[model samples]
Target: MGRMYGWVAAGLLAGVAQPALAQEADAPSKDSGDIVVTARFRNENLQDVPIAVSVVNGDVAASRNLNTLQDLSTVIPTVDFRNGQSNKDRTVFIRGVGTITTSPGVESSVSTVIDGVVLVRPGQATLDLLDLDHLEVLRGPQGTLFGKNASAGVINLVTKAPSKVQTETLEAGYYEGGEGRIKASVSGPITSTIGYALSGLYASYKGNVFNAGTGHKVNGYDRWGLRGKIVARPNDDVTITFAGDYLYNRDNTPQGVYVSSSRIAYPTGVVTPNATLAGLLAQEGITPSANNKRVNTNFDSEVRDRNYGGSITLDWRLGGGYTLTSITAYREWKNHQTPDWDTRAILATGFPQGRDDGTVDFDQFSQEIRLASPQGGLVDYVVGAYLLAADTYERYQRSVTQLIGGAPVTNNGVANYGISAQNHALFGEANLHATDALTFIAGGRLIHDSLSYFHQRVSDTATGVSGIRPSFASSGKTDRVDYSARAGVQYKLASNANTYFTFSRGYKGPAYNVFFNMQAFDTQPLAPETSTSYEIGLKGSLFGGRVSGGIAAYVTNYDGYQANFADTYLGAIVTRLINAGKVQTKGIEADLNARPTDRLTLNFAVARTDARIKHFNCPAATTCTSIDNQPLPFAPDWKLSGGAAWKLPITDGLAIELQTDASYKSRTQYAITQTPDTIQPAYGIWNASIALIGDEHWELRALVKNILDQHYANTLAYGTTAGVVRYVPRDNDRYVGLNARIRY
Candidate 1:
């Protein structure tokens, strides 16, 4: 069946190509009005780029309310976004590969770069999106030209720049069961040679989760942010730009609930279920049902996050048609959260207080200087140098109410960890216009990274009302050198069509597990992960822009795949990071766009992934369950998404537009070692929006999200004591909103 589908897809491409050649004498196809992006360090048409890339425009994002990464995934078929235990934690997967740990010293496999600056932490990428110019998702490895830690792929976000023309825009909206939001931006010329722009955003929401125990709302949200940018042209050949932004957010913490009680029925081993904990939750007024509305917790919890950053860029057009560019950036990020560890209100033996407090801070600085020769020459080249320095600190505290001298008292344990890192790199890429129909490209990078860390763990025993002293310390340092390379050939089939094939190698740096608990294996840092990928694709327009499409197939092999393992240490459970051997993923992705009429447009995207762990062997202190051929975690085999839009003129100055989109995903497992409780069944979601525009200056829109009110677990986890618990990070109920915007 899969082979038949593949054949049909290929046949459709061939059919389009045959007609395109037959009409060679005809006029060239009209532009599809497709977006342009800077994914390859230069502004180019999306279809003209020799890589598989998905572009989403600012207007489309505003209409779809794509304020977060999770919202963006609905449009990109191969992307998946998952939140960790806290709402502030983010894990983004592209092409079925990504980093699994949010600990300090570990970076994301799929890097997120904003305006040419890479976000040092994955969680920082979850900030609200406003005044965006466009977002580009580049599939496959990009480490050769892009910076390090891009073993999976890259998500590039470009914001609207300061313009010479005066413009102002304001938008406000309210959601039925979600939130209220307001955004404003203004741009104008500060002087004949300078331009400035400022933007601000505010949003708040009373979450859907009703806490029956405390009579207070859980998972509510509140946030605001501001950004300013300035551009100056000292001369016709030199330009400089500066940008800064600050954001603050606070929200109630999320609580996990039991989804299923079924245990893995191993023939030789006995596993216990959470019957007692389930009964206690029920007794505490917690109700777990299809609606998933209520959470019972005796402790108070909240999440607070603050992020601020700035960047400066200088560009100069040198003699001999060469361009020199320099980018310098600095950022600071801090986040703190308090969580109810037990998810139950009852006072149990092991989790009497059931409280865990954690805080993380990061300060990062980076500089990049690159020079590019003019394109269209017989041979063009780009060379660059990069430097990065960062400091990270994390503190965690776990508390429990225990009996001391027959009286209840609190006993707390605390752990602190810090990491300092420095990285330097030299990279270059060349494009050779070999012939009229074919071009060859090659790139390589040499990177060296050094890291040092200090950590200590301590505990205070209950002293009938007071406490005791602290414990020991540990320190370590390590450094290594790594390299990446890429080679590709692109053939121009016609003025409007192209075909390309590329092979690339990517690398991720080594990391240490920075959790509070101490496990023997976890104390030793894990090795770096690497990947090699091969891809081939075709892109072009058909029928005078009435139809357009691109299709690509890629295979990636991973060595020393990073994975988290659960193990026992003196009767207590601890998670250790390990290199779990080889993994292979091969997939095909297709996208189609059509403008059948002047007022009607349609688009669709589909992906099929075959991702599996090729080899694995558990380390000591860990149980070696049978998982040799399991599918990679959170990777669905098949995904489909499509949308349509229509615009009709109602009067000389008024028009109405309607749009609808839908997405579907197949069943997927949540953990590397497959378990029945960790599987999330197939589900689908639909969204729609209608807008009224008056002279393109004022507009009103009505949007409906999750029109079907689909019920599915956002994430699932298998716990030793709690069995299976699912976390629903988003509201399950349907959401409806009305927005109004004006521009001048």
Candidate 2:
């Protein structure tokens, strides 16, 4: 392992925020606009349930100017997400556990589902964020509901269902940050029992933000997306839906842009990369458009990207207080990109040759069928089946040039890697009411997984390395049988207070990366990583429901750790995977929502977690010792955030609203080996939005991220070429102006 995970006192401030203040039990809360989510896989009161859940509805997304899942974390506490190097690259860690890669061969620890269909690859899931009904974020373990691949939790995107009501919305926005975006959607009933919706998105950036002055070239970004959906209700007892989307963006983007931590304490170049670094210079010649680094520095790039996907669902009523539903979906996404990172790093220092034109293709299909009941009863049962298959291929060309007898000699290199995974499973959950205040949930799953890996690499006469055409073929098939049991005793201690204790178990399948990549080195197979947990919590609307909140504490143990890392010696890079020793994470979490008046609402969340190696005997097999005694990489022990939304009565049919969010994270090491290059320092950020929402159909919004004008990194990586590591900075300051529509 190259890094150690860290931990914190997770639930120290659990009772911080209050739930929504809209005081009604039968209808949805007005505090959270339309598009309420069924993220918990059940329809229940968001404030009443005991799960750790956060929701982002339609209006909230548009008003906040959130374009990708990475941007959503700014407003939602307990969520840490990012897309680095490539738009296809994304990592989402909830409760401090997740993977960092867009490579299909690597799977993310956290589970993601869209409209009940599992998203096999992160790249396919990175498609544009369009007209969605709502996004449900469930923190902690979701092993019971999500099955394999859900060691952490689940993030569900529930699209807007076909509605009988007709609606139309169009949006146009521009930013001082050299960015422009527009989106439009329309929906109406095709028949008494059928409905459909279609949408489009277009966004572009002029590539001028980095301010580096290099011909003002590599900083711009451009993209477009489309979405289509259909719903059919043949009878009162059955409903069906079909949907899909596509998005493409080109980026000649730059990365690794930094500034002086303190204007007076240091000079920019003294702390950041030198001018015309090899990595940056190489990017200039290829795709200099979507330079995220340039977007952060002098801001310039010439790059582009495209993403797309679709789905279909059928729900049927089977009478006898029972209902059955089936959801089938397919997704296809591809990206053609170019980068000059190495060139930028070696620009003037003689390492000068680096160029790569890369492309990735990802396609997936999934189907799930489940049944449940909405009636409150003493005993009930729910069962379902899920199947998923995905195929991904990535290919790239990189080259270096040199002076041969004063003439340039070019060397070209190519690498190809892919992953294909298919899963079939059946799961069941049975719930029993032991008492009026006690409900128990027990579930199990039987799954069969087929995992395959394909890899090949070639180096032309230019780069010095020969092509054995290193390639391996594996159709590894493994069957996984797992179960999750939850027993909870919810007791009414007081008139409005309910407290409960629960026990559960969950796991992430043993991925094939450990074997496939090892095959590249002609090695053997490693083991799988798994976890089990126990939790205790108390929740209920206190103070006559005026202030609602919950606090929970949990302990979890992890076994069979899998790690893939890189080692460089003599200027050459080597990569491998190893199954390490055991580790554990224990923590506490809490959140609150309070409304003091008709126009003011406040919310806050705080988490403290402790994640570390219980025993790591990697390089040495004899005696057991800790792996650097450092906290896990990317896992922060302390995180806290609060927000207040206030609506003012400015005039008739019009209201002025303001929202503010602030967050802080204690610093921690990003990788196993502790060096200046990979350690991430602690930092905080604030964002605010002011908007005018009107009656009938109009909205005007203005927002400023990094309200304090703080320069910081939301996501980062170290050691691009060994020893020389730098932090990648985001465009810390961005302000947007937006106009929107509605239909009554």
Candidate 3:
């Protein structure tokens, strides 16, 4: 850690010694004060929007090698991204609040919006981002405009639009550990009134974990995607745009490595070594330890996903300073996964060998229309109506091999389920300019949701084996009507500074635990989750527009927070989704960006989140332990991130740039049960890069991540066999890479 800090200090000193130089010809200056966002369904200066937002420009993302949400989380102190064994299990948290469940009926607390469309599922947004114009992370409840599933926050992604001028870009990168990526984009005008932009990407990475059973790396990914957009302007009053995208991904690395094995006698508070698991490990010639990167699974774990979407948008100037806009979209996503339940290849007389295979098919269609009065009016307003219809189908099978009555036996259980939903909403927001320095903002959304599900399960055995669930069939329907509202008062401190206080009400619709193990008790829909939030913030630009940032403090209380908890059923431990009684999250966040000179830029951000459960609604007939007042999973007390970049000109057409960044996270627990074994100690990672620029057409760069060779786990969980396991991220170790790009 000391060496890493020394390297950063040296780079800063070296940058200071060089004389001030002009900006790189090919790199456009991204002045923080000039950033514009659509936080309120209209273009507005970020400083005047009265919301806590973090913006990442496309150039900054490229310079920092950020291609996915997981990568972006390292730079934003208030955001955390967790990866599971498959896309369906991926989750994003904002301010220590998020939903983690595999049931299709449940909705995420954090919503992801791309362009003008909202993704129905979190997995749909896990793909690699492409050609982004900018990304805005709106902190706190955003249910007023983003609609349902935004009780916590919203991730809004805006892609580059069709450019009227002809342009082309190509980028290629290679990193240590057999990872490589290539991206290309082109934009030009096809006719006097028509313009188009197209982009494509291909990326691959070799597995980082070594699989002793197959003598090969186990966790790697291969993915490719294409995106295109067209804009047509037939008259001065109207414009139309068409956009489409497709993605294909294949990977075989979703399981975690073993950390330890132990057994605790129920109700006796006694600990003992897991002899059965130890014997299995010995038979497979495997050792268990923290940060272990080797595994000995007999079968390959694979996940294949395909996604495609298209949208059409129309904008018309309705005259008299009013604008009308409409967007229609359709999307489909399909995934297949195969996993080895036990991470060992051991043969025993009566022991169980378990395997599970599953597939998901999801489709959605949506439409939205809004009318906006032009800005500068005494009362500017926007009203919108939205409709969405979605369907999800899942097929899962669990197979086990065991010995019954001294004879070998094999049993299989299969489940098929489907969820259908429809949502209708009316939303509106208005800003009243009381005076030149004071404004009042109000927004509300009325939403109605109708959801239904059908599930069927069949087992080869009459009563099912150890790993197979019993035969069952069930169908249910639920309907919910909810509303979200927000009111705020903004006061202008100066021409470039403002302060605001806001009160908001957020809502998430009812959900049912519709999974392969659905039972009669799980058919009832969980109550809706709701939140009340109060926020105070200050935002502005200082030093004559050279610096820009914001600070915010907020407290939110939630009722009926849905979460997964462990329960005993049929003499086995099972995980189920239930509505936890109450939770409270309070935090303070601060961020700043400064361009002290034309050739230097600096940024820093910090957050302190205190998220905990206020009450635990223990289920009936279960011997549940009390976890009240415990910190929420993945909610670190403190988080910080900072970066510095400096450009020095060597000649009229050549320049060199130096950049460094680091992120720190305090200790955090990974389990809702608050087990001591699932705690992750504090850790920090540092990264640096150097680049050479030539005449505005081409450039080359070299970068290294995890300069200290930090060893840490992204997530930790209790294993199925009375042990603990952890998921190791790719950047868990030191790696060096090179990147090159060209533009015309």
237-319, model 1: which lDDT tens digit per residue?
A: 99898999998888775656666543563333455665766676678775454346667777556888888899999999997
TM-score of 3: 0.95
For each candidate in turn, the TM-score is 0.92, 0.84, 0.95
Model 1: residue 120 alpha-carbon error in angstroms: 1.3
Pick the TM-score winner. 3
The C-alpha local distance difference test score for the whole of candidate 1 amounts to 0.76
Residues 1-744, candidate 2, lDDT per residue (tens digit)?
111111111111212222231223224555432223465466666654556677766546665666667766655656676545566555777766666544455566678887787776665555457776677787766766674577677888766655557887778887766678888778889888778988888887665334344556444567787878888889988988887777777765454343211111011123443334435544543223212344222223234555666777777888877889888778777777665544243233333345556787778888888888755788777788888888888776666554446566666667677777777778776767777666666666666666666666566542252211233343444445555444555565665666766666656665655221224332233455666777778766655555677788888776765553444422333334445567677788887777777787777777888877666645322232245444665677887766667889788899987766666677755554333344456656566667788974777778776554444555444423322423343345544455555554
Query: How many backbone collisions does model 3 have?
Result: 0
The TM-score of predicted model 1 comes to: 0.92
Worst 10 residues of 2 by lDDT: 1-10
Query: Sorted by TM-score, highest first, which candidate order results?
Result: 3, 1, 2
Query: Ten-residue segment with the worst summed lDDT in candidate 3?
Result: 17-26
Worst lDDT 10-window in candidate 1? 17-26
Which of candidates 2 and 3 is the stronger one according to lDDT? 3
